[model samples]
Target: MNLMFVHDVRSETYNEETFARSYGYKIWEERYLPVFNKINVCFRNKDTNVDLNGISDKSSGPKVFFDKRIGMFKGPDVFFSRRIKNILRENIRNNDAVIVRLDSFLGLQTISECRKINKPYMIELVGCAWDSFWNHGFLGKILAPYLFLKTKIEVKRAPFVVYVTREFLQKRYPTKGISTNISNVKISKQKESDLNGRIEKISRLGNKIILGTAANVDVKYKGQKFVIEALGRLKKQGYTQFEYQILGPGDQRYLLDMARKFGVENQIKLLGSYPHEKVFEWMRNELDVYIQPSLQEGLPRAVIEAMSLGVPCIGSDVAGIPELLDKKWVFSRKKDKANEISKLLKKISKEELKVQAIRNFKTAEEYDYNFLLDKRFKILEKYKDFIRREK
Candidate 1:
């Protein structure tokens, strides 16, 4: 059967080649392509000027619908455009099944169209748009309630649901029909092996701990500010041996400025983006502590990856973090997380850290792609059976 996936992540251009090269394609190739006879993706195309050079020029397997213009939320021109409506209507009619990545306007419209046409569809609740609204700024606060309410209603309509985080998202977006927890992150055998050696080294580390976190600095909600504050507090307390590393791609001006203000500039380093392989190498070999102080998350992949490498993790007690971290490692986001995190740093013993690292590795094993695939396959099978019975 033909499968259609709808999301709001804008692409540079609309071409089969670019679609094939995108991260979305990798996900579809791994998870859905095997099950469906053919796969199609519908998303916004940002090539408003029609730059042919910007468009991908290679061959691709899955069909793509990049008819929608970018900036749906910026104004009404694209939001109320007939082009988007026709695109969704046409895709819904052509596809045998639809999977809407929820909380985005595009996903909402696609699911609504699917319902109108009596099409079978499911929801992939990857992130909380409401929580995002709360964290990002004034705009997010304004849109959070509407998106949250809309998603709650749309979720009930979906015949099946796939939640990225088992506990966090499931609690917020409850579904009436079949549902399963399938995380998006996966680790390979090589990665596991790389982690094994690094685990022993980190397990034997001394008083000089190396703390690290990987996240885009552009995401204000990541709580890098809190981390820098915690480091400053630690420094003031004479805990000066540890070093902090922040990874991922983005302008570091804000973070750098904040670090300097806190007088912990020398304590932290902003390491830019690296290949996944390199990231794992550093997580496995170079880091002692992993911090994910995000104000919100939907089962953070970076935290899980660090845990999979046998690195002890500390994060905000929000979303799926508690499911991964013990209470001692989690701090309240609303409170002075800096003070709480500093206490954990000062109080946690080396032996305790080692034990936690071992425990983390075990927890991460449960999220391995192979394990998640089995659960996902079962859900898909159930959906297929449900569809067959309907006929």
Candidate 2:
């Protein structure tokens, strides 16, 4: 078998690469390559191009191509281009199976071409892009119809669809057949010896580390502002020992200014962005509690990683988060900052926190790479037969 995984979206590669580090991408590339014999990944370098310098090991088994000039034409006009259609038609001709990661108009376009060419193709839905745009007030009300029409057409035409969450399926296409989110790899348990140095570094800072949230500050929907406000309230109530760390890239000057306005500047630390591995290390040893205040998400890897490390998480009650927690562990008043922060503080305890952390680690076992990969391969096997019958 020959498999080609097409990623039209560029931004996800950065975080995906970091998350896959615990489970080597080369190992994953090898597993899929031999199962199919030949595997190719077609993607576009929209922003910063991916450096293929160290990817040479798996480069031969699974060829990766980054087209620099693709997606030059923005908006709906992109779908009508002959150049994109021709390029996709050529790629689909040689590969026995193609997996299209949802992020670009090309994924839907390729699905249409695959249907015409009698090629086996699968659609992977990370989330509804339109929903994200709408939630942020980025997409105008005038464009709602256009977005809805496009989504409906794509869902109806695609042979198979993979959703990251049940919420995604219910909101986007209720009747569509759904496959659970599949992780290409997994993270191994970090040994205590490996974290000793980091633990010492954090211990040097003092004993009172309270809460931490890691994400790009510029993304308003991530809800760092809400956490900041919550922390300010906690400080006003005489919770002086706690420190809140916001880690990621983007302008933190305004956030810092906001902290000053709230008189909690001393308690808030804007760590900016660090290397992914370093951040993961910090999450394991430096942080006391992990919180993801995002207003929306599609099975965020940060929360999953924290859970895997036995870090108890307090996330906004939205999307797939409750599913991840199995409705057992969650911040009840997540929409109300002050109440949520109060609840979090009340829940923290030496013995109770440790017990909850163990539960968090145990919950993450179901999402392990081996388990998800097995589920995915089984789906693909059945899907292959389904497509054959259709042919």
Best by lDDT: 1
Best by TM-score: 1
What number of backbone clashes does candidate 1 have, counting pairs of residues 3 or more apart or in separate chains? 0
Query: What's the TM-score of each model vs. the native?
Result: 0.86, 0.75
Query: What lDDT tens digits, residue by residue, belong to model 2 across residues 1-391?
Result: 5666665543213322321122234543634543455665555433325542232111222343433345445545557888877877877887778888664566767777887867867777665555444555445345545665676667656667776665644466543453555643255654444334333433354558658888777767777777777767777787667788888767887788778877888888888666555667778776777888776666777887877777777887766777666344465534675567566765566655566566777777777666666676777776677666866
Off by over 4 Å in 1: 13-25, 44-79, 189-196, 203-207, 385-391
Residue pairs of candidate 1 with colliding backbone atoms: none
- In candidate 1, how many Å is residue 3 off? 1.9
- Worst-scoring 10-residue span by lDDT in model 1: 51-60
Model 2 residue 318 CA deviation (Å) reads 1.4
